[model samples]
Target: MVYYVAHRLFSAHDRALGARVAEHLAAEAGADAVFLPFCDTDEEDLVADVKGLRLYQLDTRRLGGLTGMIALLHGPSLDDGVCMEVGYAAALGVPVTILTTDFQTYDRAGRVPAWQFPDPLIEAVAHTVVRGSTLGPRTAAANRFAAFADRNESQIDAAVCHGVDALLHAPAPVRPAPKEQRGVYIEASPYTPDSGLLAAARSSGRPAHVSRRFTAGDPLGAAVEDWNLAAASCALVADVSGPETPPGAAILIGAAAARRQRVIAYQPRPAYTHAPGREPNWRNLMIQYASDLHATTLSDVTAGLES
Candidate 1:
């Protein structure tokens, strides 16, 4: 069976862990082939494309053809790219197994409770979550990773294999295509009921669904509902005009793109910079590439409706 293994590839340590997982999946977990994004870069033309559009397309196309996906959920905060892949895979009805070996926790003495690892939205869409050793020092980075891997390698291998086997043997479900309705789903932070974009979509005679309207008061439930709305809509207009792209919006954008829906990302201005003379943060490459249109104004966002 072929599997797409998603993991952070920016560091040597990250790459090593990815390689180890891919190797175990192949040699021991009954996988015939494992696609590693970092190692599978054959798109010479898109190699230096700064916008990252072609590269994202290439990866998603490859991922859609895979049997399943295994994503590594490591680091203090989960990698954004990996989360996007998980969302995309989930939207396609592809089984996803999350492997997290990081032993970090965010619980505080007197603060609102927080998840020990991944956000609940991520867990909600995953088929399996294979958690590794939670018995390691919080610091001493390199040595800690080595020791953690040494202790949890066998455990992880067994869990991952079991999950893959179950998923492969499970009966496939029929996934109907989205209804041919020209409705627009708007994903925005601090959702406004009468936002100009929503108004514009309605004025254009397209039925519009605001993400906040689907809130279920529970994170997981809300995420699932919002995702469903995004899937059902013909287009998704995301307002990313903030310091950072909202995680939920990013996930929706990825899912929408995976379904080949029109994704219009609106970032009215450059992201806030902490100090003057410092470079301003831009929208993430994943969002830039996944979106069919990158709108810098409300009018640009509205123009997408006509297309």
Candidate 2:
């Protein structure tokens, strides 16, 4: 009955307006909903908000600090907090309706490069693209998100358990150990320092090759294509240590793996690097993931493949 409105993190004025828009739309569609703006204020506020409705807050702005480096090493981005909120909502199957007319698309045409302007942010919204005249469909989609959320509480909790199990017993899957392929194409972010991981993977016997030298740039499109190539040829590895690897890549790989495909995760650490600083409040997501999957870290993955 209640829907969570996941809006872009912003100032009070904009957040209030976005809340009003979501409330209006949800009410018009006969669904009760509320907006939980992201903040770094205190745990009391977060605890209170999460208790009332779904929590729609960002994770961490910590990038290169200890925890941030850990996150990056594990596979998170600077914008991962927002992505985490969205992912958590989606995982809970929460009906997350994004209202964007509340803001305008700035033309940073000259100030910033054309490629950066409307791609990432625009694409995130595009996944749930709302048409101006299609309020009815948008409402329906919101309701669907709500229905998904209804089932999410239990499912998400169970997924946590699964991740933990995966990490503790990663080698239990019993799938035949993949042969040590000659050349494994690795697609990572331009800004990510994955040479260490690449070297680690190779040292373990999997020959790795990256698409480019490296720098921080968008690799969503490239990752998607590369994922498909890897899925088909069994010659690609989703080396997710790149800043450019879109959060959606995780979802895609999960989908592929669900279909009995062999998607290998070359995860090297326990944190998300893309996040900015070291915040104690930064959740230990990778550990939670390991717990949920019933396996230990991918450090066990190499042994599993060899076994």
Candidate 3:
């Protein structure tokens, strides 16, 4: 009966087309489709609007240009606040719709646009959404509302089975807590930005440390340090989606796999890539990747924890 919409924001500078689309969607759904307010907005003004619907604010200003590189070299993490809202959505089991067609395009590695999270913390916890632009153009405003209602009803049913309440919803993992030990290793690669995955390993109750600092010039050196850290670790969490294709955050999953350590490789969808000759048909590829990853639904990460 209730629906939430998450998006970039409403801005005075934005063209009328975007506003028309938002109005159309809000009217179509009948359910309050709240626009995620931008971080630049005054919180006092936002207090009333933020109440009924979930509110999200991301400081994309930091990502204005080449700052990710500079942050990689200097800051503890390049994407510190970037994942905040998504992480919260995952935790609360809310569905998120990314409202942009520009984001749906695949990158060089055959992966969906890098900006969209294929999979992340609280895996099946949020509904990653992408609205169809066609729906708003010709249909009666009322027909659009009916369509929104239909689409959302289907999404909620799927959320029930996902790890929406895993911490409290599911039984605990079978592994014993790690002993308080020295020399912990962390995989802090700029390519794999979902550090929340590290929390799963840390939950084993050991003193684990991840390398939050990274630099491009010393990628090999950084990998070596991670390997050493894994060597010292009782188990290494890695992703095995391969390079060249560079499976975004999944690359860390692959690196951990290469280390021959305990790893829970998060494969968003068998691996979609944009290599020269190996590329799949665009529309078909997008459909497959989204379907396979259950991109619109949240699943439980705790279910994969070793027993």
Candidate 4:
């Protein structure tokens, strides 16, 4: 069975760890068992272009066809792209196995809540979570990962193999018909402007559900509610024109794309303040790649609603 391995690829250490994990999995499974995005040559040309939309399309399309997905959720903060991939896999009913080596606790007040690890939305969707610990600096963690994998090989193997069995046995989920699905789900950071997108969606004669309204109060419950709205909606319009890319937006975008729902990533312009020597209009490649359309204006987003 072929599996898609998702992890951070920006840093040298991240790449090393990802490569090692893929190699180990292949050695245990088969040479062709794993599909690593960084190693794929299908989008080699698009990799050099900053505005390469096809690269994202090709990756997500390949992901949709995979049997299962294994995601590495390491580092001080979980990689945003990996989080998006997890959401996408979950939404598509593709069994997911999350392997985390980061031992740092994120719980406040030293008390662990039900949603103690990472974001509640992510934890809620994962089929299995395998935890491992690595000592020493972040730079050395990758080199030491093979030992951790060896120690936890049985657990990891069970999780991955179980996914295939569960997928084969589980009944396919029911999806709403095009006419039955009505609303447009609007997702945006509290710091960004969404009123325009909201207005545009409403003007198109479709019901608009704002994510902020549904994602308040209890964290776990809110995450469930937010996910429900996203799954039920006919389309998702997300505004990422804020100072930083909202983690929640990234999750929703991935989930929406997985459902084959229309997704419009709204970023009117580079709204971030960059330090000297840094690119001004930089945005997360995953967010842009997963979206059906990259909208620069309310009209552009509105056009996507009809498409």
Candidate 5:
């Protein structure tokens, strides 16, 4: 059974999205998906008739039946209970897929994050992790659970499809990157441009791309954009600088680091910013993050990429 484990996205507040996602995944996954959308109540914590077990009994008894897990991550932080579920699923050798909305991107593609990195434990275990967004007319969470799914339906659908495919396939799940990736992928920011860095990346004689290039053909082709330059490249160059530090670059650093990818980081020097020490602690955090190949200059970064 494929366990659909989630928290804030479910609960009394956004249960509608929870139910809709549950049903949609069940339909998409056929008989392999097993979801329990039962809410905790004064009457009971929720008892599943399948094995006549209560919610608390999941870890002790039924968790052994888990083949895979799909986590819907959102809100301020991932809930403690859901984290426990992922842990249990992990102990049971159940592969996990994390679909998140909290890490919304600067670009509307929902392909990546603007900020808010996922848990390292999640990164290490989950077979796949996808960042998603509401994208269209933003809808406020209802006071009570609503009847329909929100504008995030398609994004949710895509995430579920990946999770199900991963679940059904087990050990060898489909990955974001191609088996034989081409060159280095350089990520850019919003307020500040990375054109200088882009040129530097290309000078290394490896294929490189910026966000503008990622969305060239289709204005909002984050999903339809077949090749994620980040995933396709041997390494990635992230310049986390400018007037206001872009959250996307920070979160991208985390994701890339989590994947154990060779990341070349180039940040504005301390003198470049008026606020002292390269945008305060943010740069330090990034330095510690991409310490793998933190470069002092664009030339140095390109040199590292070439080597």
Candidate 6:
């Protein structure tokens, strides 16, 4: 089974260790895994690494990947991207196992709904349910084990074990699409310095239809960009949290809505602010795409859409 590990990429601390944790789990399970941060998908100007069956197929042999997913819920408020990924994975019928940090309290009110997806909804979709980060280290009692490493290693290792276990145990998903068919389309803005928005979109666990994946520069001419946005299932227009919207982003949103594709707009938290007397124009057209006009979080927009 192939394993996809999804988590927030914006870290104020070390990420290598967490990545290693995911790698270790994949190793222990003897499974193939890909961490989004590590993949370089800009080959051939097509961004073809992730092949979807009309945009929702999470795994396909053509892409040489697995259909099973393991999502890491690091905190009480699930990362908007992570939440989207989990929902996307589930939407496509891929078996998902949630490995969360907040599982200990078993506080459904605090941890699960933070997903903004109704209770028993996320739970019903997951194959393996685990709370802790580590199941325990892949070590022997006779071997030397450091206390510090053990604490961390166990959490990550457990996550993998549970994920693999869940995947192996769940019913297999269907793969009837013809070779090279695509599903679940999206267009991402040119990446900016702050990862908060891009990370949220890419890690939403679904593949994007349009990509600026390899570089910050524009990958296509206006005609091609206009066509891609027109063809996409949805356009995820993300940008830095500010009053002024970027031109490229505005174009995607406008074109996407014009095409009647679902558009999910995310301006990072401090979602939007305007002069006291001024109307928040940021919400003007974007709100038309949102379920709740006043909603500020990414999870709100993606919650029911995926599940």
Give all TM-scores, in the order shown: 0.73, 0.38, 0.30, 0.71, 0.41, 0.43
Worst 10 residues of 4 by lDDT: 272-281
lDDT by residue (39-115, candidate 3, tens digit) is 22332344532221212112212111110110000011212112233322222323333333221322235544432
Alpha carbon lDDT of residue 149, candidate 3? 60
Which digits, one per residue and each the tens of the lDDT, describe model 2 over residues 1-307?
2333333333465455344444443444343322234432232354442331222123211110110000000112323333434333332222222223211232233454322212243233122332121112222335777755545434433332332222222221222233333444444433454534455446557655554312224433543344344334333344444333344434323323322334444445433322222232112232122111211344554453343
Looking at model 6, residue 98 earns an lDDT score of 70
Clashing pairs in 1: none
Residue 174 lDDT in candidate 1: 32
By TM-score, the best candidate is 1
User: Candidate 1: misplaced stretches above 4 Å?
Assistant: 29-32, 42-51, 102-119, 136-177, 190-200, 213-215, 241-244, 271-284
TM-score quality measure for candidate 6? 0.43
Per-model CA lDDT versus the true structure: 0.66, 0.33, 0.31, 0.67, 0.52, 0.44
How well does model 6 score by local distance difference test? 0.44
| Model 4: per-residue Cα lDDT over 23-112, one tens digit each | 767766676867888676343333434434555666787777766777877644557677788778778777777766656645333566
Model 5 misplaced stretches (Cα beyond 4 Å): 1-178, 213-219, 223-227, 242-247, 270-287
Error of 2 at 131 (Å): 11
As a whole number from 0 to 100, the lDDT of residue 182 in candidate 4 is 64
Model 5 agreement with the true structure over 1-307: per-residue lDDT tens digits: 4555454322464566556556656776653455653432211333344222233443334444665666666654444345445544543446777667554433334675433332233454456766665443445658323313555565666665655566556663233432465677676644456348889988988887765533354333442221244555667687755432333444344445434567777765632312211222334332343436766688888799888
lDDT of 1: 0.66
What C-alpha lDDT, on a 0 to 100 scale, does residue 188 get in candidate 1?
A: 64
